[model samples]
Target: MVDAAITPPSDVDTLAAGGEHCSAHEATGHHGYAGDAQALQNRLRRIEGQVRGIQRLIDEDTYCIDVLTQVSAVKSALDRVAMLLLEDHLSHCVVGAAEAAATSGDATEVNEKVREAAVAIERLVKS
Candidate 1:
């Protein structure tokens, strides 16, 4: 398990300053929809198949290193999916919330979301 208490930078401008948004979708209309959702699903399906293959390997008494290698691959695949989702959240939801908070003079909501994102990223990194 990963630690979930890390606080993110409180300054919204600093938080929004530098990162490049790398999604393929156009920025205007595709706010909430993740463009890579289908690809992420496909990757997860492949990972599931890989897991089944690991089970078969175990049933066949396959070597330990081989099983470990496949497990690592599955972990990497899951990490990729997580990263995609995180990017989507940062670009869309987090940014929008921060904008709303700034306009409404309610920075607490933005800070909370930033903390949440920080914790999520920390977990992903630890995993």
Candidate 2:
């Protein structure tokens, strides 16, 4: 049985999932939401439906290839959302941290921020 709950990763969720709540924002500057949150939500909602549809295909005993097609679509949709969030984070959090480190002459803060970004990218790549 497919578990039906689908939660999109928000800024808080993503940050915490990676580690801390993006405390390095001070290095980059006061980072905040950098994209259209509403649009992201809408896209996630659609992806959630796609997930459900794949489940339905399985329940209906649909052809294997057809179900796989839906699975592929769902994966692609989720990847898009992840990319959007990643782009937003880079623009806001990462950039802000870099600026903050520069302004404060605290190179370690920049290192920390880069490490965080690297971890995030690693997670994305692994998945």
Best by TM-score: 2
Clashes by residue pair, model 1 = none
Q: After superposing candidate 1, which stretches have Cα over 4 Å from the reference?
A: 1-33
Q: How close is candidate 2 to the true structure, as a TM-score?
A: 0.74
Model 2 residue 7 CA deviation (Å) reads 32
Model 2 stretches with alpha carbons more than 4 Å out: 1-31
lDDT of 1 by residue, 81-106 (tens): 88887787777766765666556666
Q: For all candidates, what are the clash counts? A: 0, 5
For every candidate in turn, the CA RMSD to the true structure comes to: 9.6, 11.4
The 10-residue segment with the lowest total lDDT in model 2: 1-10
Q: Supply candidate 2's per-residue lDDT for 33.
A: 51
Task: Report residue 3 deviation for candidate 1 (angstroms).
Answer: 26
| Top lDDT prediction, candidate number | 1
Q: Enumerate residue pairs that collide in model 2.
A: 27-97, 27-100, 28-96, 28-97, 29-96
